[model samples]
Target: MRALIAVATAATLAVASPLLAATLGDDGLHKTDWMRDTFKDLREDLAEANAEGKRLVIFFEQRGCVYCTKMHEEVFPEPVLSDYIEENYFVVQMNLHGDTEVTDLDGEALSEKAAARKWGILFTPTILFLPEEVPEGQSVSQAAVSVMPGAFALGTTLDMFTWVNEKRYELDGDEDFQRYHARMIQERDNGKTD
Candidate 1:
Protein backbone atom coordinates (compact mmCIF):
# COMPACT_ATOMS: atom_id res chain seq x y z
CA MET A 1 0.00 0.00 0.00
CA ARG A 2 2.85 2.44 0.78
CA ALA A 3 4.57 1.55 -2.49
CA LEU A 4 1.40 2.26 -4.45
CA ILE A 5 0.95 5.60 -2.70
CA ALA A 6 4.55 6.63 -3.49
CA VAL A 7 4.07 5.79 -7.16
CA ALA A 8 0.87 7.75 -7.28
CA THR A 9 2.60 10.77 -5.73
CA ALA A 10 5.38 10.61 -8.25
CA ALA A 11 2.91 10.39 -11.10
CA THR A 12 0.99 13.40 -9.82
CA LEU A 13 4.18 15.45 -9.55
CA ALA A 14 5.22 14.46 -13.07
CA VAL A 15 1.94 15.73 -14.46
CA ALA A 16 1.86 18.92 -12.37
CA SER A 17 5.45 20.06 -12.79
CA PRO A 18 4.95 22.19 -15.89
CA LEU A 19 1.92 23.93 -14.44
CA LEU A 20 3.98 25.06 -11.47
CA ALA A 21 6.33 27.37 -13.32
CA ALA A 22 4.45 30.63 -13.65
CA THR A 23 1.40 32.27 -12.18
CA LEU A 24 -0.53 35.33 -13.36
CA GLY A 25 -0.54 38.29 -10.96
CA ASP A 26 -3.40 40.68 -10.42
CA ASP A 27 -1.44 43.24 -12.41
CA GLY A 28 -1.51 40.85 -15.40
CA LEU A 29 2.18 40.07 -15.43
CA HIS A 30 3.60 36.59 -15.01
CA LYS A 31 4.84 35.76 -11.54
CA THR A 32 7.02 32.86 -10.51
CA ASP A 33 8.60 31.63 -7.31
CA TRP A 34 11.94 33.18 -8.18
CA MET A 35 10.94 36.75 -8.98
CA ARG A 36 11.74 39.31 -6.29
CA ASP A 37 9.58 41.99 -4.77
CA THR A 38 11.64 45.08 -4.10
CA PHE A 39 11.48 48.85 -4.01
CA LYS A 40 12.54 49.18 -7.68
CA ASP A 41 15.86 50.76 -6.87
CA LEU A 42 18.44 49.26 -9.18
CA ARG A 43 21.38 50.01 -6.93
CA GLU A 44 19.79 48.45 -3.88
CA ASP A 45 18.42 45.58 -5.91
CA LEU A 46 21.85 44.83 -7.32
CA ALA A 47 23.34 44.81 -3.86
CA GLU A 48 20.61 42.45 -2.65
CA ALA A 49 21.04 40.12 -5.57
CA ASN A 50 24.81 40.00 -5.13
CA ALA A 51 24.37 39.34 -1.45
CA GLU A 52 22.20 36.38 -2.35
CA GLY A 53 24.98 35.08 -4.64
CA LYS A 54 22.89 35.52 -7.78
CA ARG A 55 22.95 37.68 -10.84
CA LEU A 56 20.36 40.42 -11.26
CA VAL A 57 17.85 40.00 -14.07
CA ILE A 58 15.41 42.67 -15.23
CA PHE A 59 12.33 41.40 -17.04
CA PHE A 60 10.17 43.84 -18.96
CA GLU A 61 6.60 43.10 -19.96
CA GLN A 62 3.45 45.01 -20.85
CA ARG A 63 -0.11 44.27 -19.95
CA GLY A 64 -1.89 41.78 -22.21
CA CYS A 65 1.32 40.79 -23.96
CA VAL A 66 0.74 37.62 -25.93
CA TYR A 67 4.43 36.73 -26.08
CA CYS A 68 4.76 37.13 -22.32
CA THR A 69 1.77 34.83 -21.81
CA LYS A 70 3.22 32.32 -24.22
CA MET A 71 6.57 32.36 -22.42
CA HIS A 72 4.92 31.93 -19.03
CA GLU A 73 2.79 29.09 -20.40
CA GLU A 74 5.32 27.28 -22.57
CA VAL A 75 9.03 27.99 -22.27
CA PHE A 76 9.32 29.08 -18.63
CA PRO A 77 7.21 26.09 -17.53
CA GLU A 78 9.96 23.69 -18.59
CA PRO A 79 11.66 22.43 -15.44
CA VAL A 80 15.22 22.57 -16.71
CA LEU A 81 14.91 26.17 -17.79
CA SER A 82 12.89 27.31 -14.81
CA ASP A 83 15.14 25.61 -12.31
CA TYR A 84 18.27 27.03 -13.89
CA ILE A 85 16.85 30.54 -13.80
CA GLU A 86 15.60 30.17 -10.27
CA GLU A 87 18.92 28.91 -9.05
CA ASN A 88 21.13 31.45 -10.75
CA TYR A 89 19.09 34.60 -11.16
CA PHE A 90 17.31 37.20 -9.03
CA VAL A 91 14.55 38.35 -11.32
CA VAL A 92 12.77 41.71 -11.11
CA GLN A 93 9.68 42.44 -13.17
CA MET A 94 9.02 45.82 -14.78
CA ASN A 95 5.97 47.02 -16.58
CA LEU A 96 6.67 48.51 -19.98
CA HIS A 97 3.96 51.09 -19.55
CA GLY A 98 3.66 51.58 -15.86
CA ASP A 99 3.83 54.62 -13.60
CA THR A 100 5.81 53.00 -10.82
CA GLU A 101 8.86 54.93 -9.71
CA VAL A 102 12.21 53.30 -10.38
CA THR A 103 15.52 54.60 -9.16
CA ASP A 104 18.30 54.07 -11.63
CA LEU A 105 21.73 52.93 -10.58
CA ASP A 106 23.08 56.41 -11.25
CA GLY A 107 20.58 57.96 -8.87
CA GLU A 108 18.14 59.01 -11.54
CA ALA A 109 14.52 58.57 -10.61
CA LEU A 110 11.93 58.02 -13.31
CA SER A 111 8.70 56.25 -13.96
CA GLU A 112 8.87 52.67 -15.16
CA LYS A 113 7.84 53.55 -18.69
CA ALA A 114 10.27 56.44 -18.81
CA ALA A 115 13.03 54.28 -17.44
CA ALA A 116 12.33 51.63 -20.07
CA ARG A 117 12.48 54.26 -22.74
CA LYS A 118 15.71 55.60 -21.34
CA TRP A 119 17.16 52.15 -21.45
CA GLY A 120 16.08 51.83 -25.09
CA ILE A 121 13.77 48.93 -24.40
CA LEU A 122 11.46 48.80 -27.40
CA PHE A 123 9.76 45.49 -26.94
CA THR A 124 7.76 43.43 -24.51
CA PRO A 125 9.56 40.63 -22.66
CA THR A 126 13.03 42.09 -22.83
CA ILE A 127 15.38 40.56 -20.28
CA LEU A 128 18.43 42.49 -19.15
CA PHE A 129 21.05 40.34 -17.52
CA LEU A 130 23.35 42.19 -15.15
CA PRO A 131 26.86 41.39 -14.13
CA GLU A 132 27.52 40.53 -10.51
CA GLU A 133 29.50 43.69 -9.97
CA VAL A 134 28.29 46.89 -11.54
CA PRO A 135 30.25 50.13 -11.67
CA GLU A 136 29.15 52.82 -9.25
CA GLY A 137 28.02 55.45 -11.72
CA GLN A 138 26.41 53.41 -14.49
CA SER A 139 22.76 52.98 -15.20
CA VAL A 140 21.20 49.51 -15.32
CA SER A 141 21.29 49.22 -19.10
CA GLN A 142 24.75 50.68 -19.29
CA ALA A 143 26.03 48.07 -16.86
CA ALA A 144 24.12 45.06 -18.21
CA VAL A 145 26.16 42.11 -19.37
CA SER A 146 23.62 41.04 -21.97
CA VAL A 147 20.17 42.10 -23.11
CA MET A 148 17.77 39.46 -24.39
CA PRO A 149 14.86 40.90 -26.34
CA GLY A 150 11.61 39.02 -27.00
CA ALA A 151 10.54 35.49 -26.15
CA PHE A 152 12.68 32.52 -27.13
CA ALA A 153 12.42 28.76 -27.26
CA LEU A 154 13.47 26.51 -24.40
CA GLY A 155 16.93 25.76 -25.80
CA THR A 156 17.74 29.35 -26.65
CA THR A 157 16.51 30.74 -23.35
CA LEU A 158 18.31 28.10 -21.34
CA ASP A 159 21.52 28.69 -23.26
CA MET A 160 21.32 32.39 -22.63
CA PHE A 161 20.70 31.91 -18.94
CA THR A 162 23.52 29.42 -18.58
CA TRP A 163 25.95 31.55 -20.55
CA VAL A 164 25.31 34.58 -18.40
CA ASN A 165 25.31 32.62 -15.16
CA GLU A 166 28.63 31.04 -16.10
CA LYS A 167 30.08 34.50 -16.76
CA ARG A 168 30.82 33.41 -20.32
CA TYR A 169 30.42 37.00 -21.37
CA GLU A 170 33.62 37.87 -19.54
CA LEU A 171 35.64 35.21 -21.30
CA ASP A 172 38.25 36.20 -23.87
CA GLY A 173 37.20 33.54 -26.39
CA ASP A 174 35.96 34.47 -29.85
CA GLU A 175 32.77 32.46 -29.26
CA ASP A 176 30.09 35.08 -28.74
CA PHE A 177 26.49 34.49 -27.72
CA GLN A 178 25.49 33.46 -31.23
CA ARG A 179 28.21 30.86 -31.39
CA TYR A 180 27.48 29.63 -27.89
CA HIS A 181 23.79 29.30 -28.70
CA ALA A 182 24.62 27.29 -31.81
CA ARG A 183 26.85 25.02 -29.80
CA MET A 184 24.09 24.52 -27.26
CA ILE A 185 21.70 23.57 -30.04
CA GLN A 186 24.16 20.99 -31.33
CA GLU A 187 24.59 19.58 -27.86
CA ARG A 188 20.82 19.31 -27.45
CA ASP A 189 20.50 17.57 -30.79
CA ASN A 190 23.13 15.13 -29.57
CA GLY A 191 20.82 14.42 -26.58
CA LYS A 192 22.78 16.34 -23.97
CA THR A 193 20.35 18.98 -22.75
CA ASP A 194 22.73 20.52 -20.23
Candidate 2:
Protein backbone atom coordinates (compact mmCIF):
# COMPACT_ATOMS: atom_id res chain seq x y z
CA MET A 1 0.00 0.00 0.00
CA ARG A 2 2.84 2.41 0.85
CA ALA A 3 4.61 1.75 -2.46
CA LEU A 4 1.36 2.18 -4.40
CA ILE A 5 0.66 5.49 -2.65
CA ALA A 6 4.14 6.74 -3.42
CA VAL A 7 3.73 5.94 -7.10
CA ALA A 8 0.35 7.71 -7.21
CA THR A 9 1.81 10.80 -5.53
CA ALA A 10 4.55 10.95 -8.12
CA ALA A 11 2.02 10.72 -10.91
CA THR A 12 -0.07 13.48 -9.39
CA LEU A 13 2.93 15.75 -8.99
CA ALA A 14 3.92 15.21 -12.57
CA VAL A 15 0.46 16.06 -13.80
CA ALA A 16 0.29 19.14 -11.56
CA SER A 17 3.74 20.48 -12.28
CA PRO A 18 2.61 23.33 -14.49
CA LEU A 19 0.60 24.86 -11.67
CA LEU A 20 3.69 24.75 -9.49
CA ALA A 21 6.02 26.32 -12.02
CA ALA A 22 5.92 29.79 -10.50
CA THR A 23 8.60 29.38 -7.91
CA LEU A 24 8.40 31.41 -4.73
CA GLY A 25 11.44 33.28 -3.54
CA ASP A 26 12.62 33.39 0.04
CA ASP A 27 10.84 36.71 0.35
CA GLY A 28 7.52 34.99 -0.53
CA LEU A 29 7.10 36.78 -3.87
CA HIS A 30 6.99 34.87 -7.13
CA LYS A 31 10.43 34.55 -8.65
CA THR A 32 11.26 34.75 -12.32
CA ASP A 33 14.60 34.58 -14.05
CA TRP A 34 14.04 37.99 -15.60
CA MET A 35 13.23 39.67 -12.31
CA ARG A 36 16.41 41.53 -11.41
CA ASP A 37 17.45 41.21 -7.81
CA THR A 38 18.45 44.72 -6.89
CA PHE A 39 19.01 46.85 -3.81
CA LYS A 40 15.57 48.48 -4.25
CA ASP A 41 16.98 51.94 -4.89
CA LEU A 42 14.68 53.51 -7.46
CA ARG A 43 17.22 55.98 -8.85
CA GLU A 44 19.92 53.38 -9.31
CA ASP A 45 17.44 50.85 -10.56
CA LEU A 46 16.11 53.29 -13.13
CA ALA A 47 19.61 54.13 -14.28
CA GLU A 48 20.48 50.46 -14.59
CA ALA A 49 17.31 49.75 -16.56
CA ASN A 50 18.03 52.62 -18.91
CA ALA A 51 21.57 51.35 -19.36
CA GLU A 52 20.11 48.04 -20.50
CA GLY A 53 17.93 49.71 -23.12
CA LYS A 54 14.82 48.75 -21.23
CA ARG A 55 12.04 50.45 -19.33
CA LEU A 56 11.91 50.23 -15.55
CA VAL A 57 8.71 48.57 -14.32
CA ILE A 58 7.88 48.23 -10.67
CA PHE A 59 5.55 45.34 -9.66
CA PHE A 60 3.80 45.75 -6.34
CA GLU A 61 2.54 42.52 -4.79
CA GLN A 62 1.94 40.88 -1.48
CA ARG A 63 1.96 37.37 -0.10
CA GLY A 64 -1.21 35.35 -0.72
CA CYS A 65 -2.41 37.76 -3.38
CA VAL A 66 -4.62 35.71 -5.68
CA TYR A 67 -4.28 38.09 -8.59
CA CYS A 68 -0.53 38.10 -8.31
CA THR A 69 -0.62 34.33 -8.38
CA LYS A 70 -2.82 34.42 -11.47
CA MET A 71 -0.34 36.56 -13.36
CA HIS A 72 2.65 34.52 -12.28
CA GLU A 73 1.06 31.18 -12.93
CA GLU A 74 -1.20 31.84 -15.90
CA VAL A 75 -0.04 34.94 -17.71
CA PHE A 76 3.66 35.69 -17.19
CA PRO A 77 4.85 32.23 -18.12
CA GLU A 78 3.26 32.51 -21.54
CA PRO A 79 6.12 32.94 -23.99
CA VAL A 80 4.61 35.83 -25.91
CA LEU A 81 4.12 37.92 -22.78
CA SER A 82 7.14 36.75 -20.84
CA ASP A 83 9.57 37.19 -23.70
CA TYR A 84 8.42 40.71 -24.42
CA ILE A 85 8.72 41.73 -20.78
CA GLU A 86 12.08 40.05 -20.36
CA GLU A 87 13.44 41.73 -23.44
CA ASN A 88 11.95 45.20 -23.14
CA TYR A 89 11.45 45.81 -19.44
CA PHE A 90 13.52 45.62 -16.28
CA VAL A 91 11.17 44.26 -13.64
CA VAL A 92 11.55 45.04 -9.97
CA GLN A 93 9.30 43.29 -7.46
CA MET A 94 8.15 45.21 -4.41
CA ASN A 95 6.35 43.66 -1.50
CA LEU A 96 3.30 45.65 -0.49
CA HIS A 97 3.85 44.92 3.18
CA GLY A 98 7.49 43.96 3.39
CA ASP A 99 9.99 45.65 5.64
CA THR A 100 12.82 45.61 3.12
CA GLU A 101 14.36 49.03 2.73
CA VAL A 102 13.77 50.81 -0.56
CA THR A 103 15.09 54.13 -1.75
CA ASP A 104 12.50 56.22 -3.58
CA LEU A 105 13.31 58.25 -6.64
CA ASP A 106 13.38 61.42 -4.54
CA GLY A 107 16.22 59.90 -2.44
CA GLU A 108 13.94 59.07 0.46
CA ALA A 109 14.74 55.75 2.04
CA LEU A 110 11.85 53.83 3.51
CA SER A 111 10.55 50.33 3.98
CA GLU A 112 8.85 48.66 1.04
CA LYS A 113 5.46 49.02 2.66
CA ALA A 114 6.08 52.67 3.35
CA ALA A 115 7.20 53.25 -0.19
CA ALA A 116 4.02 51.60 -1.44
CA ARG A 117 1.99 53.87 0.78
CA LYS A 118 3.87 56.95 -0.33
CA TRP A 119 3.31 56.00 -3.95
CA GLY A 120 -0.40 55.60 -3.27
CA ILE A 121 -0.28 52.02 -4.40
CA LEU A 122 -3.66 50.64 -3.33
CA PHE A 123 -3.69 47.36 -5.19
CA THR A 124 -1.58 44.29 -5.41
CA PRO A 125 -0.02 43.40 -8.76
CA THR A 126 0.07 47.06 -9.71
CA ILE A 127 2.63 47.69 -12.42
CA LEU A 128 4.22 51.14 -12.68
CA PHE A 129 6.04 51.89 -15.88
CA LEU A 130 8.75 54.53 -15.63
CA PRO A 131 10.02 56.58 -18.50
CA GLU A 132 13.67 56.56 -19.44
CA GLU A 133 14.25 60.10 -18.26
CA VAL A 134 12.69 61.02 -14.92
CA PRO A 135 13.05 64.59 -13.77
CA GLU A 136 15.14 65.11 -10.68
CA GLY A 137 13.38 65.00 -7.28
CA GLN A 138 10.30 63.26 -8.66
CA SER A 139 8.61 60.47 -6.77
CA VAL A 140 7.82 57.14 -8.39
CA SER A 141 4.09 57.82 -8.60
CA GLN A 142 4.63 61.23 -10.14
CA ALA A 143 7.25 59.98 -12.56
CA ALA A 144 5.36 56.98 -13.87
CA VAL A 145 4.29 57.16 -17.47
CA SER A 146 1.72 54.44 -16.94
CA VAL A 147 0.23 52.67 -13.99
CA MET A 148 -1.68 49.37 -14.41
CA PRO A 149 -3.55 49.22 -11.16
CA GLY A 150 -5.14 45.79 -11.25
CA ALA A 151 -5.09 42.40 -12.89
CA PHE A 152 -5.72 41.96 -16.57
CA ALA A 153 -5.73 39.21 -19.12
CA LEU A 154 -2.79 38.42 -21.37
CA GLY A 155 -3.97 40.63 -24.22
CA THR A 156 -4.63 43.65 -22.05
CA THR A 157 -1.41 43.18 -20.13
CA LEU A 158 0.59 42.74 -23.30
CA ASP A 159 -1.07 45.77 -24.87
CA MET A 160 -0.19 47.91 -21.86
CA PHE A 161 3.42 46.84 -22.09
CA THR A 162 3.51 47.40 -25.82
CA TRP A 163 1.92 50.81 -25.57
CA VAL A 164 4.45 51.91 -22.99
CA ASN A 165 7.32 50.39 -24.93
CA GLU A 166 6.30 52.16 -28.11
CA LYS A 167 5.83 55.42 -26.18
CA ARG A 168 2.29 55.70 -27.42
CA TYR A 169 1.46 57.65 -24.30
CA GLU A 170 3.42 60.59 -25.65
CA LEU A 171 1.47 60.75 -28.85
CA ASP A 172 -0.76 63.77 -29.37
CA GLY A 173 -4.53 63.32 -29.40
CA ASP A 174 -6.56 60.10 -29.15
CA GLU A 175 -3.84 57.44 -28.97
CA ASP A 176 -3.91 56.82 -25.27
CA PHE A 177 -3.92 53.36 -23.70
CA GLN A 178 -7.64 52.71 -24.18
CA ARG A 179 -7.53 53.58 -27.85
CA TYR A 180 -4.28 51.77 -28.39
CA HIS A 181 -5.61 48.67 -26.72
CA ALA A 182 -8.76 48.79 -28.82
CA ARG A 183 -6.70 49.07 -32.00
CA MET A 184 -4.53 46.17 -30.92
CA ILE A 185 -7.52 43.99 -30.24
CA GLN A 186 -9.00 44.78 -33.63
CA GLU A 187 -5.71 44.07 -35.37
CA ARG A 188 -5.29 40.87 -33.47
CA ASP A 189 -8.75 39.74 -34.40
CA ASN A 190 -8.11 40.59 -38.03
CA GLY A 191 -4.86 38.60 -37.98
CA LYS A 192 -2.79 41.74 -38.46
CA THR A 193 -1.04 41.61 -35.10
CA ASP A 194 0.21 38.92 -32.83
lDDT per residue, candidate 2, 142-173, as tens digits? 99999999888889999999999999899899
The runs of at least 3 residues in candidate 2 whose Cα sits more than 4 Å from the true structure, single-residue gaps closed, are: 1-20, 191-194
Query: Model 1, residue 17: displacement in angstroms?
Result: 7.3
Q: For each candidate, C-alpha RMSD in Å? A: 3.0, 4.8
Q: What lDDT is reached at residue 105 by model 1?
A: 89
- Residue pairs whose backbone atoms clash in candidate 1: none
Question: Residue by residue across 61-140, what tens digits does model 1's lDDT show?
Answer: 98899999888988997888888888889999999998999999889999999999999999999999998777788998
Name the best candidate (by lDDT): 2
- Backbone clashes, each candidate: 0, 0
